[model samples]
Target: MTNTHAAAADGAEPPQGPPAPNHESGTGGAGGKTNPAEGRVPTTHPHPKTHRTPDGLDAHLVVNRTTFRLDIKLTAAPGDVVALLGPNGAGKTTALRALAGLVPLTAGHLRLDGAELDRTPPESRPVGVVFQDYLLFPHLTALDNIAFGPRCQGATKAASRAQAAEWLARMGLTEHATAKPRHLSGGQSQRVALARALATSPRLLLLDEPLAALDARTRLEVRAQLRRHLAEFEAVAVLVTHDPLDAMVLADRLVVIEDGRAVQEGTPSDIARHPRTDYIAQLVGLNLYKGHADGHTVRLDIGPAITTTEILSGPAFVAFPPSAVTLFRDPPTGSSARNHWRCEVAGLETHGDQIRADLTGELPLAADLTTVAAAELDLHPGAPVWATVKATQTHAYPA
Candidate 1:
């Protein structure tokens, strides 16, 4: 992290740290370019019969760098928490930075509460960013760190401190107001960083991997707290994270990005149940395949046909959980499962309390079984096996 980016400055700019690749050069001459597919997808995925208010966030961020290009549209209503979820180097941070005005847009617009902020400077925009590291000023006490934003916005010194104190109380950090950043725990520092971001009453809040810095034990507690806080927030909040759990738990909607573009956007449950891409399928722990559906079977592009309960036609997707697959040492003639494949165990790994076997041969798939079952079958790499999944367990959806 560079010292410039790591500085715990108020929203005048992003928190100081190591510079990001996409932020190296701001946009130039990007205004003339247009994305042909931008209109193909709707701006927001509102619940059935619900209408998104116009007085919220509407942004189509585009940044053209030498090595990367980010072109994704984001929209949210007040009180909506949207998560930009993807893998590393998928432009999640770039999208967050563009929204924060830290990275200029090459071609697209940013609007909040009916105001166009495409050209607004970081300090002037109505945005607050909580960095991944929770960059609290090393020299300042918790109270002062929270007060910094309001002070920079021209609030009276005493008034800012009072507001900071109120926030500290609200965050259950009143006892830590006098402590410096170094003296605070990871969770405490995160709360302080959140308090600082909220001190200025930003209309839009941006969080970059808000829980990435916490350990497993602390993450559980803080994640619950963060969810509550996000639920209570009245404005739009956009979170950038590679962790699927964080996105699923924190956001009302998930925008799945990959290679700098949005591949899917939907409610957490909807996305989990009907993943559109392999990346999302893996993230949600499903074995997904695209194929042509006929009657009750889907002929996958790569693997053998899978018989599903759903009767669909044309392009379709079939998905089933690894746990739904049952592996046998030999092919059974009287098995009731409608889908069966002669597969070879390619690898084995411990997944939670189960053994996940990655198999190849007639059909590639992952099967999850108990350690006892694995031992009974003597499962190992290169072992011949028959994998079966009940037709009722596979879900088929249109592609």
Candidate 2:
């Protein structure tokens, strides 16, 4: 939008632009921190399971307007956490809204458990949602907050409060049941939000950045707790998150959407091992290469071929973690690894204890080395280095 074309026209390739998620700056940490909870109450969720839905959580999502269009499909089963991962403006939320019945489907079918839900209104659809902000009522106690859903579903006031108590106890918020939303902590509020949604017992559960509001310390705890809850859920649960780590840990499978289209969909490990797009490649912090594998070696279209432990017969992918690459200040006269490349350090950034160096050469790649190694090589933004990767370190799978 800022005339990025001008830079490309001037002999420079366009930038990758801002990272998919900048939530770390405000509340979420740099891949390590998360957002603080915003207060709110909500309804049903899903769990993680190895089983697949034979019929799937069928959806042919279609929403059209003068400004944009959405056409996509998502199918999963009960107990499978399907993460919708993408950058902003990728229509991830739009597709979720369509399935939730908040946005009308211009033309498509939304079926869950063999029932037609697309034609139904949001309230009529037994779907639960945990929004980015945990919109809890400031005046209500956490117990009442969790119980609000059941009361709306026709339970008596006393029974609802009782059910809310049970849920609060499960979330480890029994002591804070009487506390108002303002009196609660971010992590507690998130649990309350999740509790409220699950109280409704929805056949389909939706979460949008569930842990995006927590800090680093709280994120670790909440992530583990959320994983437990998802494991407990027995219905269809779909979560939309920008963080790759969250998607991998919270969801059973991933459905990546970009520009309102389904770019890729597979198990988190599957997608991580064989990334088709640069976005997915960067998210997993891996050097991905598409190549042909035959017998003992895999060949890339680029400068060097990669050898792997597993021998494949056809098209395959060779991937290695950034840390697996070793950098040198000069071309090594002798090296143990067969795969080596000379590259210019295009950029460098600190990721926790190590620094990730983005290199430019025969092929753009990111390599991670410890601070000691980095200092030894005197790595800098424009320094040249020789990188070597051991054959045993490379992982190859069918492309």
Candidate 3:
């Protein structure tokens, strides 16, 4: 049977009010010509309840290629921001494209506010996309780039520019409106791209790695700005990103995809505290192990037994952070820790203010210590050490 789940954001709401005036003209005209007097775009932004489905978006997308297949389901309320997160080539982008109508779906359904969009063309769908590269028209000025969407929806040049101006002001890019794409900084260009997408006031917004183009410092600033804009948006938003921090910060919920399918989906805190897969565990910076459990003892599949406070049975998973591990130059004669493994230091590196030591031995693990401690122990690669963790430090849950 196919897996289908309805994941709701904590405070998601149904479509509210008359849609912001700056984004009211969501649909555009037939040949890029504005319909005078009517002043409205041809597209539909029906009240969410009018459609009869759920309040936000409900989609089951399946895309098949000769080399790969992607099948995933998604649901979000009007005010929710859902982040599609995974490693490279994990089908996060494919799912975003399918939702945008850029890639056709082989099967399943797509609906927004009760409208079936599986057969809708890209331009007709009430959706906007911000690609990783920004995809700005290099030849056009910032104002024109943002105005292009409004113009396509049949607004007059004057009307479109007026709307574009509002979006630019909101993005704090009014000063750069006349600048061409090449002249704008990466962060400015990204803001413009976002403004262009939002100019149409789409009922559903799709962003593909929105901050991947900016440098470290710029990313920090842009991420904060993007988060503020998203909170004010009264529509469903989905963003694709490989950065776990980005997903955790900007999204109300995270959908972790692996091997073309959604392996896990939940609020960021929930997934971080209880990751179900090794990839997620590593992404969240935890050492995870699978084992067979008998009461409080778990025999790891890789040949080690761990004692935990939780009395779980059958298959189980154990997780602990690198900080929970302690390293000693020699095995201690009388230690309160219940777990001990003789390991050889494979490598050492600075992790923030602490030093992280990579070890290989009876059990591979990462241990964290202070720089002064490392210097006192004269720690280095190829050094032999004993690693131990108290039973209380490890968390155990049924697999």
Candidate 4:
């Protein structure tokens, strides 16, 4: 990756031409003023003054459609990789498109490096986008695909190809450089997309479900490679993904969106340790309950009261993993666990090597037990069982 960066910096000189006027606002181009002598894209916009912003990328997009409305705020530093994580139709892609200037914002601002870019066209914005499908040109070889960006930026064909070759080597795809997109593997194609985006020297990079097209094994390999590249990126990067592990592993911070709004934004550890919404909780693999808290107990709205170690008042939330729950065919005669619920097994399924029992009765919860224990208890749907959890196993926090 370092080699790729060095090669891009060394191979193609910056764009050289008469500074194109910023056509959108009848003002000079922002952050992309061209210099004929140096052939470099200005790091800062013209009207906004030449100064770096505290935030590399700052946006508050509001788009209203007939059926869906998207409103989300995003901020990141120059070296930060922020992931927009949510379930399908959560507007992750819409937000990415808005940032890339592909979608119009009905309201709010878009700024990069202290320059306002709300009106900039997609081609004029100092942004690069890698779409979910890789979107490689089928007729273009991997080398030509990577060189496409530099060529658009006014690099000579030879210079662009040289830069592309360097990036191909860095991505370990030099051998496949001459192969067209259709001939490349999913992982290789993904790398080509990434190289093409980076070759533009964008100050703001957007990737939408960058690995969604790959198979499981290919995804694992591509994810690691993408993470390394993202870390080495000098500017702000925003990636949209529904995969919890991808968001946690690849991003410096996470912005969880639901129904077009940001529900939570924090470091991965912060979100994993304390999920605020049921969607987030489930995504992180924890059972979440909302209820009212009095002292060390929470009375769930679902009719179950959970005992926890934290003392709290008013509305609260309690979460515990399925593994924290224990199941018994009969109520234990002498159990120290303070939280117990009588439940009937609604269903059972294999979760890894353990059997996950979904229960419904006094309290609805999921319990995970070893297959051996499940067999010993003869656990099956419609069977009655007692679920127990020590109060210490649950975490309670203010709602």
Best by lDDT: 1
**lDDT (CA) for every model shown?**
0.78, 0.73, 0.78, 0.77
Expressed as tens digits, the lDDT of each residue in 1-399 for candidate 3 is 000011002111211211111223322223321111111122222112232224779999999998989999999998789999999999998998788776889999999998899998655677777767776767668887776665554556677678778777878888998998899999998888777777666788888888998999999999999898787777788989999999999999999999899999999998998888989998998888999999999999996899999999999989899999988998877899999999999999999999999999999988899999999888999999999999999999888
- Over 12-46, each residue of candidate 4 has an lDDT whose tens digit, in order, gives 32223222211111111335322110011222210
* Model 1: residues with Cα > 4 Å off, grouped in runs: 1-54
Runs in model 2 deviating more than 4 A are 1-56, 65-68, 292-315
User: Please, what are the lDDT tens digits per residue for candidate 2 over residues 105-201?
Assistant: 8998899889897666455566776766776656568887766555545555677677788778878899998998889989999999888777666
* TM-score, predicted candidate 1 vs. hidden true structure: 0.87
What local lDDT score does residue 152 receive in model 4, on the 0 to 100 scale?
Answer: 53
Q: Model 2 scores what on Cα lDDT?
A: 0.73
Q: Candidates 2 and 4: which is better by TM-score? A: 4
- Let me know the TM-score candidate 3 reaches against the reference structure: 0.85
How high is the lDDT of residue 179 in model 4? Answer: 98
lDDT of 4 at 83: 95
Residue 114, model 4, lDDT: 88
| Model 3 stretches astray by more than 4 angstroms | 1-54
